[model samples]
Target: MSSQFELLTTRRFLPFFLTQALGAFNDNIFKNSLMLLMAFTAASNLPMSTDILMNLAAGLFILPFFLFSASAGELADNMEKSRIIRWVKLAEILLMSFAAIAFYYELYMVLLGLLFLMGTQSAFFGPVKYAILPSLVNEEELIGANALVEMGTFVAILLGTIGAGLLMGLEQTLFAVSCVLVGTSIAGYLSARKVPAVPMENEAKPYKWQPVRQTKQAMRICFEQRPIYLSILAISWFWFLGAGYLTQFPNFAKNSLGGDSSVVTVLLCAFTIGVAVGSMLCERLSGHKIELGIVPIGSIGLTVFGIDLYFATPANVGDQILAAGAFFEQAYAWRVLIDLSLIGIFGGFFIVPLYALLQQRAKPQERARVISANNIFNALFMVGSAFSGIVLLGVMELSIPEYFLVLAVFNAVVAVYVYSQMPEFVLRFVIWMLGHSMYRVTHEDLNNIPDEGAALIVCNHVSYVDAMLLAGACRRPIRFVMDEGIFKNPALGWLFKLAKTIPICAKAKNEETFENAFKQIKAELDDGNVVCIFPEGKLTRSGDINPFKKGVERILEETPVPVVPMAIQGLWGSFFSHHGSGIFKSGKRFWSKVKIVASEPVAATSANAEMLQDKVQQLRGEYQ
Candidate 1:
């Protein structure tokens, strides 16, 4: 719904997108064509089995990520990124020329070698492509920009993969594939030439040449922050998961689904389309912010859908290979497609936030290097995944479906382990689920919340889940100050505790509780954390703004943090609000449209409970 496509018209982003997409397209075309040729045409002449050859091809392509990502990261950090991209694209053109020659001669070894060279080019280009985005786009546009890149990349991959397979089936296979690959490479180079220059970050820093030492240095940069390190690990695991699934698609279609090459194309198109759809949806779902909440949702969907795929797949299709149309005619085949598509959808959710977070949070000087570290780990994981699949399917003699089940189970374990390490991801997921399920929350001017340093958030409490909704809308973590009654509720208390929400009581009822609340607020603000308080003190019984309590003034007086006023609209009649007689006895407006309007920050000197309430009222308008 957002204007993500508009970025394509901009000089800063358009050329880069075209360059990246063209590269992906060429890579997939070459890889898929070679794999298809080996699997069918050259299987008899090749020394190795088709499966082994495919695995070897996959490993060879990824080898550069492990070997050169460190050096590439350094170069990206020290060199002008756009210029580096142009040079990389030129390398791509040369490599594709070699690939064209290999295809013409049908030189198997030469083709494999060219695959490695292509991988090398991509490895060098990866850091520059990702790291340059922060320079080209502002923070708010990062998610949308990444979304477009992701969509374009996968779509290009889809076209390349499908086109290669189709072209290889033609009479003049070598000539057709070569022409397309060479053209794509040249187009990529031209696009790279048009990319607007992005200023270098560490132009004077000496570039590292030693792969081993530089790789270690990149790892150190990644380990500099725990979240960043975890993100890299998570991203690597995604590649592991993706590699396992993608590598098995051809075999799965042939042996498992009892379908021919066309079915494999269906599987590829379905999954790729699903990923593109999911990536495009991220900008809307995240409210144009780098929301990590989608990570958990994606992980869960991936596990669930992955496990379901095993069940959806039958033990065997008939001995005869079914065409694409016939494959879809089978009732169970549709289910398999759905499972794979959902897996891709969830995969989109899992990776996008991590990428955005890495870009936004990593130190600018070392960001590209950190990305290289991520690439190295990703390659390692993917290669390891191939071996693991071989062991499970070959040595252990597990069926392909059984291997899928195993991967799904492993995914669940890994997701739980990661979330256990960082509960913030899960916390945000819970907040996101609450907001999305209960209301359609449209955020306006939510970026008014400061990115860093302490800030006091004053909002009118409209419902029981207002804090969760607010947390979901604003990118920052908020420690909500809730009334003692709600804080002590058994059902909701654990959530508040997990979020570290501050609980306060009426001064006359419990002076100690009230006093401790202010102390905690001061400590949090002093530590440069956001603290949110409902200055209205209690939910409005009349569906109108309640009078402001003096506690907000007292806390602001003590902390002197910038006060941001936010208003929640369209929740008054909901089940969570104090409509009719009590909560849940009133209207149950499931997925009711709501809005969160955040006004500009009021200076601590000018801020008061009454004035903040007035600002919230103005923002809320007649929605309540």
Candidate 2:
């Protein structure tokens, strides 16, 4: 049977997607039109000069992120998100109004003012725009939603950039620009109106005038979660690295590919599509959790492809390269396109999860504040990216692909450092690798697994490979509550520890170990992590099954959330089950496979010792 992608079909995503796409298109259209006007036509006609005005326009646009982003984030939290978006869109309309007037009257200063106002609108809208997703999307849908947003934005920008370039290059560029702005503004306003209202989370927080002071306080609170800080740094640094490449790609195409702006467009398209593909696939790749393994893989791609592009590229393929169309004919040029596209693809895989992770994991009360803090770092990195680009390409005179090589190596080095410090990323990486390498397993009704706030997985005891199989199928990384003896097995010890597996023993089995194990599992689930335990507490030596223990209920009394019953199927004779030697003493390294049947989720109330065992036995009936 085919699956309908529910996330993409939802109303919550569609309206916002269109609104953002229109806004991006509008921004690029006007910005590109203005660039053409000032660079060629306006400059030629001006009595004094146009470069100063152009520079002022650029500064005006970016300045709002620094001034208004913090306030915007707070506003989104304090008021309805959809309403705030509407107001932001209204402001965009007003900004475009001013632009229309400026274009008609030839008022350059007025145009610059509109640009500044545009920046202001974007600033206030930025935080709410990204931070609102966790509330709107299911945890599993985050990756898909984010990917769509990004992809749509890029598509709009690409189209707008091309449209603006063509129309603005005409003799009556201002009128063409004015027409584009008016249409885009109209489209934006209509889309914003269609957006459904989502109520504010923070209803009572005081809104005061001390923006700087409040921002600092918010930043202080956000960094309290160290992993959050690391994530911020990683994300910010990506923008920094990406900004250089983005800014330079046009020049790189012109200089190396011996092509014009059309090649630049192709490069942009490839990269954008790559990101779109990457972002959309993130939901599937990471299995709906924030899998940091992809970050390493992305980093590696950034470095490796970057280096390859440098070597594969021959300098000055032609002294005077023809238009962009001819470059495609060269097989060598295709490499650059593929490289950029993959870089973007990997970049999406790296970024989307981290963004979702921040939203889902950050304290709900301070979510907007954390988002604002992220904005601060983002602004810093983007600004820094401008300088980095200049330093690497201009001052150092490094070739374009060589810059790519440098960025790639830098990504690898930084990734290693980040993963080493917080081993969760590396741990997830190991799990990701193992799961992919293991037999293909289709996980359905995984929502049959709880999202958070404590959960115990009760599964029938099958074989040595039961936990591994179950862990692979689960969306969340489960802390397997296992017997100490099995945990201490030399062969799988590393895997267990990496999974953060907690080992428990019965008082009769090992008192100190049991107490320690209970304490650890209790703490883990209490903090809203998934904990899995086999009620049998050991592999069934008998071909049938083993009796249940009250240990599950005992743990639930301390940290109760949801108990999910999982059934291991088809493991009876797959080399590890009791069908042959029937014990761990047998040294049979056998390649075999089986299916895991995940039963419907059970509440802690229904998970008494007897009921839980009966439920699993039923699910495991024929397979076991």
User: Evaluated with lDDT, which candidate comes out highest?
Assistant: 1
| Model 2 Cα lDDT, one tens digit per residue, 375-428 | 878878888877777798789988887887787788888888887777777766
Instruction: Give the per-residue lDDT of model 1 (tens digit) for 1-624.
Output: 257788888998999999999999999999989998998788887777887888789889999999999999998998888889999999988988988998888888789989999999999999988899999898878998998888899999999888877897799999999999999999999989999887767756666489999889999999879989899989989899988888788889998999997898899888888888888888888877899889999999989999999999997678888999999889899899999999988888888888999999898988899899999899889879989988999999998888889999999999998898877788888888887786787888988999999999988888888888888888777889999898888877878777888899899999999999999999999999999999888888888999999888888888898999889989988877877885556366656788899999999999887788789899889889
**Window of ten residues with lowest summed lDDT in model 2:** 1-10
Instruction: Return the TM-score for candidate 1, rounded to 2 decimals.
Output: 0.91
Off by over 4 Å in 2: 1-10, 45-57, 204-206, 287-293, 461-469, 485-492, 505-510, 525-529, 539-550, 553-562, 570-594, 600-611
lDDT of 1: 0.88
RMSD of 2: 3.5
Assess each prediction's global lDDT (C-alpha) against the native: 0.88, 0.76
CA shift of 263, model 2, Å: 1.5
Question: Which stretches of candidate 1 lie above 4 Å from their native place?
Answer: 36-54, 451-453, 506-516, 526-528, 541-547, 580-582, 586-592, 617-624
Instruction: In model 2, state the lDDT of residue 297.
Output: 71
Error of 1 at 220 (Å): 2.1
RMSD of each: 2.8, 3.5
